[model samples]
Target: MVTLLTGLCCALAMAPKWALPKILAAQDASTESLGQAPADDPRLAAVRRTMEPFGPIESIRVPGGDTTESLVVGHPGHRAELEVLARELPGATAAITELWGPDWAQSALVVIAATPSEFAALVRVGAEMPTEVAAASVADPFVRGNEPTGQRVVFSPDAGRRLSADGLGTLLRHELTHIAARAETADGAPQWMLEGFAEYAAHRGRGHRFAEIAPTVNAALRTGTLPEDLPPDTAFTGGSAVASYEQAWSASTFVAEKYDEHRLVELYRRLAAQRQDAASEDRVLREVLGIGRADFVADWRGWLSAQAV
Candidate 1:
């Protein structure tokens, strides 16, 4: 999930949010297996070295259910915050499991950056971290082929400062959903659907009203200019990026409501497995949803209008 850096000039505003895309330079398969390594292992020394410039690093192992394990790292001073997130991870993992099932890795890692620079450095997104981005999940794709290695969730310093506990919980669930679906996600998958599916899982049972969360799209629908297609990649990095996320979420929500959650997951698998483009997208729409792209758009627009504030 990419978020545009806020307060940037028009040219720099297009920088993408750092995330684990479907393709990345894979790390050595033997570098360090996740969840199995001890916090004091020599390999983790490198992680500590990388974070040393920021503050004293601390690590904790939080036991998950029988299927998953969790570890969290943060500055010594932020122990309270890290503990809070540690408590949230199990519930987030359970939620994703219920939505997509337990086909993902057996372990999860979370990092809490003490500063914005630390956040940027951990995610390897360069020196200039976007002010608006709250957190990112990253992993090496090449080490395990389609599977991820060294997967971890990194949070911007502002995240803990600004978000309520519940808000942070929702965000963690969103990134965890990405982690669970990473292997199945294709480098060429539709960004809209990817974000939409994650958002659907993140917001499920959160009790947020549609009008409260989708004011931008709702306003557009009231003006009768419904979006004609899924959100383009460009929509995720520059102006209206947040609105694009909402639109994507609304699209996935519509699917879950109109059909069923299982069908939505099936659509994701079908699209993720195929080579996606404008043409393949149309074919996939017909093949999976039994409708043409035009009809899908019409139906989605109608649903949007119905939910408009």
Candidate 2:
């Protein structure tokens, strides 16, 4: 079981959709050990010093089997710690061996190294975001530089390997929706709509969780705070965080249910293409849905309320 960490961007927070091609390298079957033991080298000492700031140092254990010494930086936020590690380790080839996160706690990132030199280098370089914008951020952050790491899938290891088949498809559908929506422009997008669209894409034609209307309606009924409408700038914080996602998913679903699928795609395409424009989303929404964002919000809220009762 992998421990997920905080600071790592989830679907709600990442600004762009990143995809990478998988790489595969030919291996020498007889070359059993992938790691070389460190020679009490001064370089390893230097690398450790660089990584000291992120969190508590529980232990820096060497990797078992053919793997090199592994650095397990405990309690550090995944994004910051990994970034720090990347900066300290400028290795020849570094691979993410495993990543796990608790539902409500920070995540753990495990990396594998083939040699002391490689391990030292990886820890040095892990702190920086990839130079390539395309490799920026994802659920999985492993990419083998410009070279292919391995290829069961077209995307980088970050994308293609993190989830089970169904989960991968769901995540892909959500990410692809961002591509369609162009929500990742300089102007940015409202979180509710952004996540809502992705959620709709992920669960399209499937029986609804909120649509059974049990969870949301019951919550709303209990709180007397069921939202009739949502604002655009919804974020992943506070009570609104979870509620907003539920509302957005349901709202987008309502739009899909009433409108054509191709229309939604066109709406996203138009919005994405005009990402630089300040008014692009509204313009696209008006043109595609024959309604403004405000009107659409009202309608969706009304639809949600009707479903609840």
Candidate 3:
């Protein structure tokens, strides 16, 4: 069986429900009929309280046509919050459905339940998560939307237990980046680039630049640990996986900074076009950047060494 692993919403008349009901009774009627007060629940209350300073809460909904009774929280920064959330969590389906202005959505969204106390809400997000993608274990393992529907975010149990804004934002960025590119490049793309792209996007939004870590990567290269070429499937054993990802992230950051964002997309597109993955990627890089692998590596090393120490 062909395994299709991506965060894009597969178009279907029905959105397969993503829930493992531990607390919610299976017999409870559909959300369309039983939409309850979000304020009653502690989680929803917390969400509401956090959002209260900005505006009132509004209804949250899922693609399944279920509406969540919520308070609409509208304020200046809320819109940016949603957009940032949307950008950072690209794997989830999200939309600023009601845009009052450039940065404002009519309501601050807390989907699946009227309140956070609903265990099923968390379960539902978990259920929608694409299990095929492997990421580090995080609290409330969630994803941001990647498709036109908006950001599709998944919040695992851990997200609620000890949620810190910084950590949540990082997680949001990582998973959402998954949502953004999940549909475009899954078929023949390299996993290292896949993750590297997401990692780069996540950190970049947070003002963290890979250039800051170039020295570390350069040191690895000097030790002969860095592969002359990007690591390939045959080389993807456990020994190389972690290091390969770091290198790929470094290379991706370098490309984005030295070249441009479109160039990164073009590089992936070219790589996907060729049947041979690594060779295809190299060809694309050489064609676009006009540098051979050896020269590119040497230049990259020198560039790393010259960065602001």
Candidate 4:
């Protein structure tokens, strides 16, 4: 979630507009089942054709601590790295379930493309994806109202090489939080709340202080350019994207510090569920937090100042 591709993935969750390419039927099932499935084994090829257009080189079932849930990894190579990720699944899932509850899907599918082009093909975001994005949690293409047919976290091939173990863990947890909350997530939900909440959950109990996690915002505050409001969606895609991310994370942190964590969750649900209209949004603000939008912004600004100092 630390790159520009995050916005594109978030947009996909709100409106699943892309179409997946259709796969052709396998000609012979018995023939495909002949031997140890090679990279291009007809059986693997057939399965890939049916499930994914890019045809991942290989996939394996990773067992989770809970018998009911599992993680599936599709990768072109770097089996070692995939194994490392597999080991981290239980911890990540535990962190998310601890806060969001256990009502989400029983399985997670992770795709690790061998190259950027392959990653783009899997996610289908095309030219809009930035090279810097390490990973994304995308809603299933077949999602219907209130029910996501499936969800997966897709990792750029470079992610395995680019990110350290801790960095990778944080990235996975962040994306997983998105998947857990995707069903309730609204397209029109305030970007700050959307991204901020995810960041907050991702960093929970990681012992990162506010100033350390949000140095950009701290710098901005020290320069006397106090951000008066939540960042617009444009900020997520613009040059100030990193700072925008920090601002959002700080805002969510502020909410949790001043109010209760459950209130933060309620705020997200109410705002995300309401129509994307000013009047309805304002009503939700007053009803849920007992404050108007202006007052909330002022309060957030005050919190930012205090944190920066």
Tens-digit lDDT track of model 3 for 1-309 = 011232221110101111111121123233343233345644355344434543454432222113322221223323323222322222222321111011212222332222332222332333433322222211122243422222234333223223333344454444445444433444546655665665565455455434332334545655554456655543333455445555666666777788877676566555543344545555766997877666766765555445433
Q: Candidate 4 on 1-309: residue-level lDDT in tens?
A: 332223235311110011112112223322123222345533234225434655445555554556744443555455655655666667788888877778786456666666667666656564535766767776544346567654677777766666555555666777888788777776666677778888888778776667666777887888888986778767876567778878888878887888878888888778766335556656877988888878888899988888774
Candidate order by decreasing TM-score: 1, 4, 3, 2
Task: Output the worst ten-in-a-row residue range by lDDT, candidate 1.
Answer: 6-15
- Lowest lDDT sum, 10 consecutive residues, model 3, at 11-20
- Stretches off by above 4 angstroms in model 4 are 1-47, 50-60, 72-76, 141-145, 274-279
- Overlapping backbone residue pairs in candidate 2 total 41
lDDT for each residue of candidate 2 in 203-245, tens digit (9 for 90 to 100)? 5543334533235444584555557555445344544454566
Measured over all alpha carbons after superposition, the RMSD of each candidate to the real structure, in angstroms, is: 8.6, 14.4, 13.2, 9.3
lDDT of 2: 0.38
TM-score of 2: 0.43
* Candidate 3, position 172, lDDT: 49
State each model's CA lDDT, in order. Answer: 0.70, 0.38, 0.40, 0.64
Instruction: Tell me the TM-score of each prediction against the true structure.
Output: 0.84, 0.43, 0.48, 0.79
Q: Which candidate's lDDT is highest?
A: 1
Off by over 4 Å in 1: 1-38, 41-46, 223-225
**lDDT of the structure predicted as candidate 3:** 0.40
lDDT of 4 at 66: 62
